[model samples]
Target chain A: MTYCLGIVNCFGIVIAADSRTNAGVDYISAYKKLFDFSVPGERVLLICSSGNLSMTQGVITELRRDIQNHEEVNLHNLSSMYDIARYIGHKSRQIQDRDRQWLERDNIDFQCNFLLGGQVKGEEPQLYLIYPQGNFIQATKETPFLQIGETKYGKPILDRTITYDTPLEAVAKCALLSIDSTMKSNISVGPPINLVMYKADSLVVRHTLELRLGDPYLAKMRKLWEDFVRQAFEAMPNIEWQRETEASVEDILID
Target chain B: MTYCLGIVNCFGIVIAADSRTNAGVDYISAYKKLFDFSVPGERVLLICSSGNLSMTQGVITELRRDIQNHEEVNLHNLSSMYDIARYIGHKSRQIQDRDRQWLERDNIDFQCNFLLGGQVKGEEPQLYLIYPQGNFIQATKETPFLQIGETKYGKPILDRTITYDTPLEAVAKCALLSIDSTMKSNISVGPPINLVMYKADSLVVRHTLELRLGDPYLAKMRKLWEDFVRQAFEAMPNIEWQRETEASVEDILID
Candidate 1:
């Protein structure tokens, strides 16, 4: 029950992930899901994970280990965004191999998914949704954003709002609205959000900020959105045909 | 894939369901998911099914057969809304008993769920979410709704809008908003919505409306909601404290 979303806009890339992780209701804890792998001015990539905490953390650690030994393939050494997806797949597969047998024995699904996006020094910004099976799909003009875990509740706003030509700031707004919707419905997705944005071509990490508990702006946005929706609900016209026990002028109809 | 929702409002009840049912993309068909049994002034019962179409259809058929047989237990003869729930559960279990052995041999999990809500003569209106296991839970003043199948996309707006005391017309509006959101994200849940409403204690249905693909009012509401979201998006502040590319804002200040 996690939420991680990434959007590739004309100006750059936007990445957002919630911090809640749970093994069960009692084991709930905060775990940072966003990882930065880019070298300033050389490459900038933000990767977010959602699902099996153990499996995702395993993949992240594997990537970090790969980066440490330049001889091994990793995000820092990869020349293109597509290679990033392959490398992530390879690592995820490696970890799945270790647990696949055990997971099947217990009837526990080894479920995990990830959103990997950012710029390599030479290429345009890119976004990819890496599935639990160690395969991945890159976002294109038709689908300029990718989400992983608990995605449906937040999808309509994203499907309607995001575009390849959208400005970076507006992308942030869409991402937040998406998160706002998810957090409102799911208790397991409580947030102290990890939000990051990378400017196109600059290849350096520009904004990698965390809004922890008690963050003012998120609180304000939640209230403002709720208030707006309440007002909108009131503004909708009452059904012209429905009757009242005690009829009023609004209930009157003419044929 | 399907989406079905039910709402209990001050004026009455609103139930709406999509008509799409698919075994696979190539096997998709339009099958109605909503069924109502109303005996004017005596009782009104609405049922929406999501999951295995055959299993749900079986349950529907069994209930109708009971009615045809003049069975002692049917919505028409049930003493209270809870009794109606038990009847649905009993029949659902009967269907499962017939199907489970064959389904298990094929290695497919048992999949089915139902949401039943309405009023019987001499009893208050009630809503219940019936599980495949024959257990049920009723909605309370704090939670005045139930949803079945592909439910998440529509759930957020419900969290933001529905209450036990919400007016009947407003409940219908909210139900549309909910189903509309589900349809926007899920292609498997599509057009020709079946929406019904019942006022408390009146027994008979008050409104059983249809919203088709080209319905003008629904189309207008979708556009208005999208526009309103766009306006709300623009009103939010662009975080000024975001780091810049020329020099890391952190480097400039921290150094």
Candidate 2:
């Protein structure tokens, strides 16, 4: 399992992912799920993947091979973020097509999902959640975030906090907190979190951080968030119990 | 779709549920999911249901009918909370068994789940999650809460705050917040939210609330929680950026 999120707002874009993957409870391992395929001055592109390890690796390898081999259509050459998303979705579908039969024969799930966030030279920063079926949906002004893989446990916070005009740095912090919430609720999503923040119109990636297991920053942030959440909960007003006597009085009056 | 939660701590048991039911987006209606069958001064029995509307309704109807008709084995006659859980599960299984073939022919899901929480005269208060297969598991000291239906959105807070030692009132508040979080994230779970709080050894339930749509208290709590959560997020420490120059120096050293 994996949890990857991409947030695109007026200020910039933030993409984050957890590194843990498990074929089963006993077969868990850490892997880099975020990849940077930026051209520095040309465009900024980041992809976060979740689902079948072999299938995603195949898609990533093929994408890199296309770039290294300078194939006509590649991540570096795509003119628009939409086109790049389409290319990644196409590659994902291809990998699934190649292995779906074998996986199905063994009753294994071969589906994979990807979150592609980037900015091309002329367009605004964009985020897209590419489906396993080669379809994709982009984030918009009203809903400025997209998530994939173990999504629900971390979604309420995003729904409550993210807006199109949120500051870029604050969005990054929310992304980390979102993943931290998921990690606390689910064992499938663990650490070595990868985060990248790309400022709008920059056409380059400058800020990146990888929080490994037992990272002090991660521990400190977790402790602080937990404390604050408890404090917030404690601050919530107590429930006003509706007394049974009053209800009975109302009931007798109705009768 | 539904969201129901039951939290059992040393102080007492709190059970809460949303009242929304839907066949699809087009067909949403409200029905009470929390039912009290408490024989005051004897047992405090509260049950919350989730899953297929017809199946859960059928289970509830039959449980009521058995008690009304004075059947040989009824909920009122059950000696322990475990037996009561088993009795509810048995009724649930019977309903599913009756409808299984017809539902399967149309590819409809016939499964249902129940959270039965209460105390019998001789036994301590208990909470059990009864599965579709007529089996159940009790909440334990290590994990003092059990939730059914649309549970994930509200789970992080529970994971962060709930324990066996939590006060009953606080647990009740947590249950409300948990359901509120779910309602915020999902449209299928909505008001009027039903809540029941039972103090240990008080077998009779004296505190309950049904928060309808646009209830002032509910609105106020929602606003306060949003404010507090934002304040909490703002209070969180910002990420310390690891400069590219530092990373490059470390890379040079490694090389």
Worst window of 10 by summed lDDT in candidate 2 chain A? A246-255
Per-prediction TM-score, chain B alone: 0.91, 0.94
CAPRI band for model 2: acceptable
Off by over 4 Å in 2: A244-255, B244-255
CA lDDT, candidate 1, residue B211: 75
Instruction: State the lDDT of candidate 1 residue by residue for B1-255, as single tens digits.
Output: 889988775556788899998877788788899998766666778999988878999999989888999987776787888888998988888888888999989987667899998887667787889999889988877788888889999999899788878777778888888888888888888878888877776666657777778777778778777776776777776654455557753443321
Pairs clashing within candidate 1: none
TM-score of chain A of each: 0.90, 0.94
Q: Distance from true position, residue B10, model 2, in Å? A: 0.4
Instruction: List model 2 lDDT by residue over B1-255, tens digit each.
Output: 999999988888999999999998999999999999988778889999999999999999999999999999998998999889989988999999998999999999999999999998768899999999999999999999999999999999899889988878778877888888899999999999999988887677888999999988788878887787677667777777665433332233211
Report the C-alpha lDDT of model 2 over A192-215, residue by residue, as the tens digit. 999998888766677899998898
Model 1, C-alpha of A169: deviation from truth (Å): 1.6
